[model samples]
Target: MDMGRYLFRQVRGSDAAAIYELAVANEYHSDNLPLNRSLIKAYVQRSVKDFAIISSSGVCKNPLYMFVLEDTYTRTVVGVSQIKNILWRLLYQLRLDPFLGENIGKLALKKEDGTWELGGLLLSKEVRGGKLGKLLSYGRLAYLMSKGLAPRMLISGFLKNTFWEYIAIRIGVSKEYNPDKHWRSFKTLTKFMGLLPAHILLAETGIAFGYFEDLFKIPIPIKPESEPARKLLVDMGLCFLKEIEANGILWHGAPWKVIRDDNFMRYKVPQDTIEVDTCKTSCHLDIGMAVLPSDDFRAQYIPVAKLEDGRVYISKKDFSCGKPKHLFIFETKNV
Candidate 1:
């Protein structure tokens, strides 16, 4: 068996090829996502350049990011999620023709209070609902915490007619809002977008392709449905936000929900492996970082430490922003 280990890192331009494959898989099931080979390639290049500049120079930061789940042994990109330091809302004037004037939406993140949003949680068949999801999701939070950009609330939207959206509606954290006044057009667009080849669709848009892609990011409205999951969020103290939602043709129908829990950070950080003794020349943690137990009892990100005299040693504290820095990868057979 080829040994493999999982890792979370800032995406680079070189990852475009691998990530394109992953995006294809995601677009296969979720038709509303406006990701194509050309767009993803562009996304990779743009994001890599931006992250490098941000990571090193801290200038002209876009605050728009995509994090990938990698299998180091195979050198494959398995999954991806997007993060934004701001949320842009579409603002359009209801004109003589609603569709014609739909061009007035903020294509930038919200700058007030510096609220960050987490979206685009796409995982591979091998990792969805598994430990990798937790690691990837929490990893974003960890990175944000390190940069002191952690938001008091993390916001996201679920697509219509999905199990995840079903649960979200039930939890009462979000409600569905639809814009375009004529939701019929909106429905037709989503329904038909997935029916055709992605490349053809992109070509059809011509110079307007980028703008179309941004519109796809907006969450469509979903009807409120009751479910047991709603009670759990209520118990956890999560509340729905009536004000400050994405306003425009972009997210007219999706109910924007917010979660507030100071205690939620505990679950996003790897408390078990984030600490290491810096006093010794070298020290060994029982397991290297991110070597957590998966949902099916399989080990994800299993770390391999060289054992001399059956001991592990390391020097320097493994922490950033007062929290444990996450593990990248280690050789292992687990996948």
Candidate 2:
């Protein structure tokens, strides 16, 4: 169980086949997206490009990084964890429209005021016994902290289950179940119905239960056995933010003093590092607080700053003046 034998590194194009095979084998549990060779290839390519940009620009704000746990003996990837720049993309593409599209961005903007989300933690079935999950989870957070992007608050969503909730409670991140909670009642009703045979439930409600079931199939069952992992997360300081039916999301925050502590400062900023690439040309000034430059654009890491006029400025080294392009300012924070 020497975890050090498995190192984390940016995934490469050559890894497409291995990743695709892994995804295909685990599709029944992990991803519902259609399994196709072409699509998988495209995903790998996009991920590679994204890692390149983040590595080159020294930007840690984007959740586009895919760190793989490699088996040194076999030279294979055994586990993967992901952080996202934006969490609502999958929800949006599905057209499920949980909340209005505009509101989604607004909510993210609001959340960014003090928090960031940590999600998409998955590991191969073979690698489940050790403390690899914990290591990977903390590793991602550590990476974020190094970029000066650690958010005060960190959040994660979990499907409803006693095991997971118990874990959250143990970590002091979740509250004891309260019958008065609105979401609790909703979840109880949903689970009750979910227990019935699918056809029976569909017949009773006259709702296309299969469609919804297929669409939102729970990859992992909410069993009591998974409480250990849940407890571990809560202990690390995450709490329940909101719950939808049988699902709930949690939040955690690092104390202000802890964030400014000397140990944290040294852990976050690196002294020796590669120089960041700068813009090749001058850019036009825009009437915006910050610009949401495309991930394709080449730019240096810019610290976010507040202006005297009550506007925020994402300090960029150069304003690309070539095209009369408009850039939307995206909220910046580390997850």
Candidate 3:
């Protein structure tokens, strides 16, 4: 899927400066990100190193990719998403198997097996409410699936939100949750409040309240209202399990979602049916972006070329530019 106006590419060392600008913009919404210029530079460097050779092999194995979306016309870096092929070591150390056994039903995410984490997705507001998001999501899967590198399972953590709640209802995740399980299992309050003195906490509630009044104000285990999680569920067969994981947080208190890889084959759009010369139907649309009548053909990415047969398409060759070499495209609207 080509993002009509924007092209997605792996981050290069040179992209650090531009990505930093984008990162800082997201920093304004503290929940979105908190990267300073230096961390942003290191992030780009890590991404470049992680995917340097394997990404182009049509499969990225034992991989990680930090993708940057560039405005084809403006040439500015506008959006980004990150994917990692393996779950990090920290999850095991956190000791959350009981949570998974109790809340996640039959599925389990293991450290040794191939599991991929999809996150670090940020799209500029201009591209937020449309197909751009889906292209980035499905395109990665398309790439992974094609290379036979698709994980045995998929996992992601998100800030709890109305969209997550909606996904829960739509996918049969129960809402009969204690909700306090988040705070009890995670110990979020004690960890964050560790900044304050022990004596202040050991004192009477009255004294503790007086000494650290502000800390008590914020609610723990923030419920997230994510529209994006719904799109992920559709494209990747993911569901919001009640279990919250510490691998990543949407803000400070996001929950995790998981599903088996077999679900991808079960749920994927049958791309083999669509006949568009320049497009593959496997590229899914955003949640609710689908038109009612199946015959309707709305353009997601207007191809750079319409063949003599009137087939509209943008091929992998077209996405190559100086800054963006190997690519995927995602845009809010026709450019």
Candidate 4:
């Protein structure tokens, strides 16, 4: 298929059915999540609201973009790539604690610095072949850069499997943090106390009480079939940052610039082309801002921009609070 005519556009309300079908297909293929049409509808609605928030804030001077690869010939949508400014919120909502909480703590401690994240890249099975995956992946990077959010790193979490591990190794970046290993020592206590209320236990122990067992990875025989995908990620310059077996998964980090240079911007958003649209979707919203407990909590706010000259800006500020700043996390397994 000639991909030239297939432009990537922001998903519209009319795309609910297509998006729902895609979610169903993915869930069926991966055994990842149960397919519920109402849930998928909610997800699409949330995406629309997030876009509106970005536009109204004028934070990046562009709406937080979610692109759906459209077959101009058939007018069918094929894939999706989205850039979320506050992706940690998504991780938190999913109750993907420890993994997201650890990172949020790191971010709080480093409040003087600036960082952005790219997330949620899902492509249809038919389009997973060839350079299209790479195109959609990097295509998102290009779009973010244009929005003035040139993120230093692109973070992703992959399931613990030989195929994925092998891919990280090939990419020349591999680290192991077994969530299971970390949780083994605490399992007995957790199991014994599992019946007690979490708040009561925390009060008694002076330590937060939460079961971390479900996050650990179970060792399974690797099928002979799963190595190629791992190889591809390694070849693309992604590396394993750490292994959190206690959480049943591994955390990987990839540098965005390594995939493509600044020049890749031309392929996604053209210069001097400002397109705007209205999004009137209803969804839940939560905002979290926190200051670190460390000294010198002076917040550093920097502007994000697409132009080399820095035409767009996002401001960050520090605020005083009774407890540590609240961190928002978002996660959805019920697709």
Q: Per-residue lDDT of 1-335 in model 1, one digit per residue for the tens? A: 12126766667677777766776765532222235666667766776665665657475445667778778777887877666654343212222226553333222223434455555556677655444665555556555544545454554433333422332344343334223222235443343322322211011121111112222343333323212223323333444332212221112111122232343332333345444345432233323334223211112333233343333333344321233233433222222
Which ranges in model 1 have alpha carbons more than 4 Å from their true place?
1-4, 28-33, 91-113, 150-153, 161-238, 242-261, 267-335
Model 2, 1-335: lDDT tens per residue? Answer: 54435545456788767766666666422221124667656756776776676657654454455556667679987765555454231111122235543111111112144444555455667777765665555555545543445555555544333433443344454544432242325444343323322220011111111111222332323334235556655555544332222322323334323533532333222212212234332222212221113433211112333233433332224333321122222222321
Top candidate (lDDT): 3
Sort the predicted structures by TM-score, highest score first.
3, 1, 2, 4
Q: Rank the candidates by lDDT, best first.
A: 3, 1, 2, 4
* Model 2: per-residue Cα lDDT at residue 27: 47
lDDT: which is higher, 1 or 2?
Answer: 1
Candidate 2 regions off by >4 Å? 27-43, 58-62, 87-115, 159-221, 224-226, 245-335
Count: clashes, candidate 4:
34
The top-ranked prediction according to TM-score is 3
Q: What lDDT does candidate 3 reach at residue 221? A: 31
TM-score against native, each model: 0.50, 0.46, 0.53, 0.46
Report the Cα lDDT for residue 263, model 3: 43
Backbone collisions counted per model: 19, 15, 9, 34
- Give the whole-model CA lDDT for all candidates, comma-separated: 0.42, 0.41, 0.43, 0.39
Task: Write candidate 3's Cα lDDT for 1-335 as tens digits.
Answer: 33566655556788878776776666422222335667667766766775655545544456766777778788887777766765432221122246443212121233545666676676776566655766555545544543445466566656433322332343344343222332234354233222222211111121011111122332233323244445455445554333333322321111122332444344333323222233343342322111111111111243332224532243343322211211223222222
- Cα-based lDDT at residue 277, candidate 1: 40
Q: What is the alpha-carbon lDDT for the whole of candidate 3?
A: 0.43
